[model samples]
Target chain A: MESSEAGLRPPRHRVSPRARAYWAVRASAGWLMPVAAQVIWLAADTARLGPHVAGLVLTAVVAAAHVTVMPQWRYRVHRWEATPEAVYTQSGWFNQERRIAPVSRIQTVDSERGPLEQVFRLANVTVTTASAAGPLKIHGLDRDTAQRLVDELTEGTSADRSDAT
Target chain B: MTERTEWRRLSGRMLVIHPIQELLRAWPVLIGLVFAGTAGGQSSWWSLGGAIAVIAAGMLRWFTTTYRVSAEQVQVRRGLLRRRLLTVPRDRIRTVDVTANLLHRSLGLAKVEVGTGRTDRKDDAVKLDALHVDEATRLRAELLHRTPARRETAREETATPSEVLLAAVPAAWVRYGPFTLTGLVTVGVIAGVAGRAVNEAHLDPGRLGPVSTLLERWEHAGLPAEIAALVAVLVVAVAIASTLGYVLAFYGFRLTRNTLGTLHVTRGLITTRSITIEERRLHGVEISEPLLLRAVRGARCLAITTGLRVGRGAERGGSLLLPPAPRAEAVRVGALVLGPTTPLTAPLTGHGRRAARRRYTRAVGLAALVVAALLVLSWTAGSPAWIWRLSLVLLPVAAFLAWDRARSLGHALIEATLVSRRGTLVRRRSALACEGVIGWNLRRSFFQRRAGLATLVATTAAGRQRIDVQDVPLGEALRLADEALPGLLTPFLDSADS
Candidate 1:
């Protein structure tokens, strides 16, 4: 772990290793939607394109690329750190974005574990503020880690609120 | 304080004025029905019955509504069957505005609207449709001044008279009207009215006698000449309408600041308006200069105050501390509104050459994308190649704009205030108190990272919520956050040795 003195640029922390499997499941679900539509079109006689072989091939290639390549790339790019002062998140691949939410500004911290995430023991933490830019989402953390982060954030914010007024 | 339990009705004049206003609103529908009935050869009795029903409903509504003001809250009870008792706490009240249209003014009545900070709910405001002018003014003062005894004591201690900040004369309208987009807005309004009139008339050009003859005369003149004439007429009409609108809206405009820490703005020629905003609630000031207004060295000043959640239209009409005036005058008023020591015209620190390059790249890329889209469209539609060739001229213009935008982006930390200036077409300079900043947001995209730049947004509870200093160096952004609010970011700073 990097020293805490890094200020707003906290040391990069990766999500749980099972995040790759979780992403694969999500990617397959997304790919199946278009593949299913293409299958319906191929079976339907009234389809305008009339069973496009090129389109089918392109779709398969795109889906295969997403399932195989995207998860690893995402894992490399996704980094988050929760300190006493702020929550830092660095995400995205092509247009990588780093965001910092000061602890004092945080209104609520919520941890949600979905059914798919339950299998992998993963959870996502959302930090909400009054900002119009919407909530700050920290995805793919271990369930226990997410819970501890939430508790830490809540405690920090509550301490700030008493002194702020 | 004596316990008052009686629920008082609005001024009796509302019974007459409300029904008349309701009838006026139904005029369009009544006219449409009349036309429809005449065309179908139906009786006029149906239209007459509809008018009576509308008037009866209006009267019933006026009779049923009643309001009461207690020490703790103001309650308005309305509706006979489905009664709604809206209770607004006395302390929660933020603004009190009184407005009077021609009819209301003639009847010595004004509409009093009490507003709280909550804007998400439509019914959060308490509106008394009609009240005696004197009573409205008194109520406005009472609601705005929460503690009357304290205000009186404070006023007596200061003993300072109200100072006039700005008063618009007829000549000021002529000087500022053309600089604003009011002419464009007037043109849009004229077009809408004309379109609606044409639809209602349904005049067939082929069967029309006078209109066809005029069309023939126009045809005798070439189509090009006819189009030119139409365009010239529209321009003249819009200019005249805009000037008239400016004169009508701000003929008797006045802005005054009192010792009681309240600002009173009274304006309008036909429909008079009185808006009161407390100085304590004011967060800061913003000086805005649109592209056209900037050309004329004109600017407008607005107050960034909390708990003044007037609707968009009302905000434009009321929140203006300084209307389209000289840049110097706007700055002067802005400084005055902010307080004695805070100067808005201080030199701001410019973001560096890397920011300029980033802006230029983004601007040129966007222009190129547009040109490419045009070329593709022309190729697919079999249009002339010159269509896209003409768009290639946008590159130089885009470069100039990007350079201008980069130069304009600046931020300054002046004592306890943070001033940020941005925008190419509508330049805005906002000065916010550092104490008001509740949080800080730091963002850096991939391009920004390569350029060593990031955007620092200061989140506050006042106007716009977030004020961003875009494309500043990453280190500078971190330094700004730390300086603006100490101890908040220091804990996370990396050790120097790292």
Candidate 2:
């Protein structure tokens, strides 16, 4: 929390509270693949494979730890703010990053909702510039908030006539 | 030139040239087909039929492809059944490359490639396969917004703006070639092809030149002697190959600033390549010296231009302002290309001891992790004890590299240029015009944050498109960003008291 306030403060606002549940479910869904592989290994139970119960146990421990810890960490780390001049975002839990793209250089602004996100009444907003360093993505926003953000970003970018590059 | 709306098919010369080119390409296959026909005692008619099919495919391309250069855009329509149309706006055209092989030259024809800086799709470029020399020159000149400038290579040796020469690599510069491993790569490619050919033909590789002698002697030679001989052979082979590659690619290299303002690069031996880069599209210059090249005091200079692809295999092809030459020469050419103020020679501000400590930690930590893994493997698998012992050598090397890498970490702002230098193995110093930077990224891993360091990246649309000054103190990173573009970061920062 202190580092989030370090030098440059964290962005002005957080995403929708429901994003916690969405991320928890998403993290669990990702953990399923490794869990499924371990389950299959345990079920197959080949003696020659040698004491493979360790694999299942290790996977369960890591998967449980990841699914429980990651969602809260991400929600705490992710923050975003947009103004007439620039868009700023702080993302990632362990490897944190802050990106600043001037409105004059913004090439496109897009908003979309996946099937799960729609069920959760959530959406994602992406603002990109011509540079290949890539887009700024803010996920787990309320659908209305995302739509408003997209519109506001569109308005800000269109008002600036400079070349994106 | 008046506005022209009509679609023009490729030069009629392709109809004649295509069949011969196709026949040449398919000769080995055709020969196999003939042999198979003879062995099977089938009619020889199918061989001629197969050859005709190859020629037909080639000739079909000539018939199907048509293009038109309008006032607003250049459009190309091609394909028999697919009917694909590629259109690029004239104003978006960044560079024009004209190429001609010996055959094309004999026929007085050239291939024109129009680049629009679009990386959205492969082969989006509009290429006219065979155009008459004069027409290609006129089109290249027009596309670049100029009358064809006189070139050492344009017959129209073709298309350069009337220009002032910037720098030309002399033939003696080829002495620097052996230091870089470009020739080894060429030899690798050649060896791969030769290996495939030998496999397919079931031929003996030993019969080729001195290879048989080496193979015969290898049975009698001791291990150390054999290694020494092998090393000597490899050294000679690589040096010879790279020298040949240097001569082939940069034989008549000339960089010129044309009257129309674009930079003109004309070079090649058997197959000539002329590339024109728009002046405004150029963001900066990068001077690179790989470790071996550094030992030899050799370096290469490249343009950080928006449209051209550089680095990897593309490094030798386009955006290269200077080939492997003396380090001083590289900087001189870098200054010449960047113009006026020479940020290329500016002294960079080094990150303090903390950044150096971080580099050592990361590098030594990585080496320790590798040793631990090897230990685990050796214990479980009962591998040779010497393996992990041998791995111990990497620890000292890693520490030395960490020291060098830390030494390389520095960034500075000189006049209007943002200079950043990094990398121990391939030390790259780039001087970017601050205006080319479109955005900024300040990143920190948990360890980096704990260490109070940030990797500040300037995201641009040119060259690699992102340049990083890694492991500077977070405060220094913020200050650099603000200084590079004074008010750009000020709006987003919250009271910069570090």
Candidate 3:
């Protein structure tokens, strides 16, 4: 490949095909809830503010908005790559917020899933910060992907800074 | 000083202070009210007699209530009908406070209260209302001595200050006044008039039988001069009683500290209370300048606490160690009592104080408009003549607020404290330590942003105290926030992600 082509090539395309397939599974699993909620609401006939035609129009507009604004789900999120710093999940398009927790700051990792999430094999990762408040949360990752990320962050590379004397 | 490293169970006798016991102790007051009303013919003989009988029964039941204490827990069993057995662990107790009533004080007793940290329902504050002064002190000491390790595994702990600099003990007390003499006199006059009005409004013709009989007896017994003398004596008695009631209800103010860290404050002549603050829980400090006291240059300093409102610190509201002292004296005395942990000074400006005053005026102006609108509506509807004069009351309040606004402008510089003065009814100089700042928010409205002004609100775990410098340079606010963050986070750095 030309030097310019190499520069534009995306960083994670080097991962195995299985890993790419895993990323697709996680992305679709996460989008299922809003899609399901929209479908149910469409058929319920519960619109109170307007005529049925108007209700249908309103519902379509809302559904379209939700689909357009769904958070990016194609990227393969990782804890850290090499230079030794702990990685954190940075999401939320509007706020563009970032949680910078080092591997050392990982007090504990709890993986949880609700009934709906479990049906689609998706899990939630809750990360606690130092103070009692302000815990970071990453939602809607494939079960296996979530486990791998937690293991990579919790057990790999950097020294256990929590045990630093 | 003795080292207290373990939680000790309260004495078994402490259970006599349980709520049921308090209900029992108040039985006499119930009986007294019934007796007084019956003798005054305010109630029927049958109803009065029934109340007396019930009070007697309740007192009898109270004598049977009891409690038990072990090394680790306290259990109390009370109530004759629906009994409750409350068991609380000693280690879980956060604070032990004491309060005194006339009966408790005369008997040399204090109500020992235990604070459980949970806010889900009410605090688990069980009052042992009749513990001896010594017992209450020992119990408080015992609770304070319990080590943090024994309670939880938290790495950070509340440590006591050593090498004491200033402690205000009860012995160094200067008479603290809540209501000035002039204020008290005005209150008495208003109260007397109100009392007479209420009596006339509630009076019944049937209830005048005793008064008629007394008048008739006096008429037959002697000279017209004697009757006139009797009336004069009665009026004088009422006036004296009203004045005395106003003063004593607001009396016995004492503020003191030990050379060590503990501060003891006791006030209220009738219902006395002594509070001991461990100091760490004192999240913020406030010094206020009320409008009336502006010319006198008097201010009151109060501490902000969690859960309880200001001054809920065992000692009634912000234990006023320095009651209405001059500016210099207030600062000196406040710093001494607050100790070295507090910044020696605050950084505020005349401009900031003026801004604060303007804010107060804005609030008062809004109140006046509402009152004026209401009065106009009432007049249009042909309401009472007195309703027209009601709006006039807002005039004095507005003038007072304006005066307060004029006086409210003053700020001082402290290396690590932000001292801001603001108020109308109560002028306060608030001192917030940089160490307690949890987060800071810099907000700029469109106008403010254009004017190069912003508000930096430092939120502590306690509450937010906004420091607004209307024409303040924006760069300064951000720099101040940046400077404040390092000190605030130092204690929590061992665990913070950053």
Candidate 4:
């Protein structure tokens, strides 16, 4: 076995710079859930004076650490490349994934923009095959880039007459 | 049959059956209504109105539903208020299922369910609930047999398509059924339901007639002895129940390959089910051996095709080709089903020493953690010594499992099919057609990367949707992917330097 075939190299392009802020906002929103739950729990059981304050402090520390670290890690990890032959992507900060699907097998290509993504001019491009393992979602991309990718994928998919199954 | 293209209503017998079926469905509500009626006043009026409304709706459904089969497509129109029309192109039809429960059988009716390959939306499931048995058979044959070119000549062709019986095997193979351990799940379910019923009725099971005597005996016999007796009873119960379940589910089980390029499977005792699969849609076959089944050298076979799933964990399917049978029979059937040329019996390539080491580390490491936790708990909480002592037994069991898991991991690309084998407790050897593979997923965990391995998942539309080739060397994974589909990975690969 040769070094060239040793592993899948990283995909070609990184996402937009605004994606970092967008991810930070999204991550902070996720972290808020625990804080909200803790607050409601404390309110429900005001009688429990001993552990609630300590729990709240521990939760804040964990949430803050997560909000601070996750976004930057995700921004660094997320990369995508769309070629005429295939779509290659690398995502996930800890458990990294490299997915490759031939253009012939591509069933659908869609671009979605969340409410917050609109503020950051960021979007997600989803490319799917017939398999239920699910679509390849490239998150936190510039809206224009997402649109172009979708267009290119749609064109590439259409040009091939295979059933894409 | 009525010029082949005319829109037709459901069997007239449905008019009698539908309202009865609907009324039966509303039994609990009907009981509640009856109670309300006993309370007197305007409640009786409300109950009567509700009953009438339900019956009227059921009766109305038969009139609203009408279907037409044409040369190009099958079109169905239903619902009086919504008036939705569903049209499926003739070529897109992947499977045609005809099922008849006891009531439907008694009424000489069958339900026709058509599965088009695009099964992404639940709404796309096209079914006509109650059609005449004869009509249903005719419609199924017409829908599934004819190609677009041959559709016009279907009526003229008097002789039926030739059918080669792949397996008319159920009675002779009945001995293999109990080994499947399928009814263990059913036993658990029955016990759960019984327990729930006892709880709801405020009945103490321990004080029940024979149960009270059994409890007294168990209390005197000690925990281990009591558990051993219970296990013995459960095993006997499960074996008997398993045989019964198998007979009921696979009564007169037959797999037939038709001259028209369709595979037909007809089985089930109480609720008769006949599944017609388009031969072209078939990607592969899976021969699965559950632990107990493997102990007795028994295996079951499922078809890997578009449109239907191979029902996870249930040992039930819309895709089952063979129920629990001898492993040789399963292999033979699997090979025959995949067509004559497939090397389903070909030896697989193992994932080497590193993969085995990884499996051992994960399994044994996890087991050790559990044992350590139990020991720590014994020290901290002053728990019983027996529990932590029992945890020590898990170490050898976990090592055995890891060894089995390592041995089970293998994959091979034979001809145009990619054969992958994995899992220990429920070992599955899946052979998938290369053409059916839609994509490649190279997943490398942080630990897996350090081990120079990747889990290569071949994404397909059939059976579990993805066949995992776990912990293969990165080079081997790339090579397999490249060979599986030539152009898919070649663009991204670097120039090989040995």
Task: Report backbone clashes per prediction.
Answer: 7, 6, 25, 0
Q: For candidate 4, what is the recovered fraction of reference interface contacts? A: 0.71
Candidate 2, A8-93: lDDT as tens digits = 77788898889989998998899898888877876787764655677777877888888778888999988999878889888898
Candidate 3, residues B1-498: lDDT per residue as tens digits? Answer: 222323344334443434444455455444445445645755445544666566565454435455555556656555566776667776555445577776566667777666543321333345554567897776676555544355354223324323333323232222323322334455566666655544534544345888688667767867767768777765665545544543443355555553333555555567666655545545556665565455555555555433233334442353355444455655676676555534535445554442444555565777678777778777787767666576778767777666655565444446666655655576666676655544443444444444444455554433222343232344555446546654332222223322
When sorted by TM-score, best at the front, the candidate numbers are 2, 4, 1, 3
TM-score of chain A of 1: 0.83
- What are the models' TM-scores? 0.85, 0.91, 0.53, 0.88
Docking class of 3: incorrect
Provide the TM-score of the second chain in candidate 1. 0.89
Q: Identify the superior model by DockQ, candidate 1 or candidate 3.
A: 1
Rank by DockQ (best first): 4, 2, 1, 3
How high is the DockQ of candidate 2? 0.57
- The candidate scoring highest on lDDT is 4
Q: Which candidate, 2 or 3, would have the higher TM-score against the true structure?
A: 2
Chain B only, TM-score of each candidate = 0.89, 0.89, 0.61, 0.88
Local accuracy of candidate 4 as per-residue lDDT tens digits, B73-122: 89999999999999998878889989898889999999999887665365
Flag clash pairs in model 2.
B149-B160, B149-B161, B149-B162, B153-B157, B154-B157, B154-B158
Give me the overall lDDT of model 3. 0.50
Q: By TM-score, is 2 or 4 better?
A: 2
Model 1 stretches with alpha carbons more than 4 Å out: A1-7, A11-28, A45-51, A64-135, A139-165, B3-8, B41-57, B77-85, B148-170, B204-214, B217-231, B309-317, B340-343, B496-498
Chain B TM-score of candidate 3 stands at: 0.61
Instruction: Give the 10-residue window scoring lowest on summed lDDT in candidate 4 chain B.
Output: B307-316
Query: How well does candidate 2 match the true structure in TM-score terms?
Result: 0.91
Say which candidate scores most in TM-score. 2
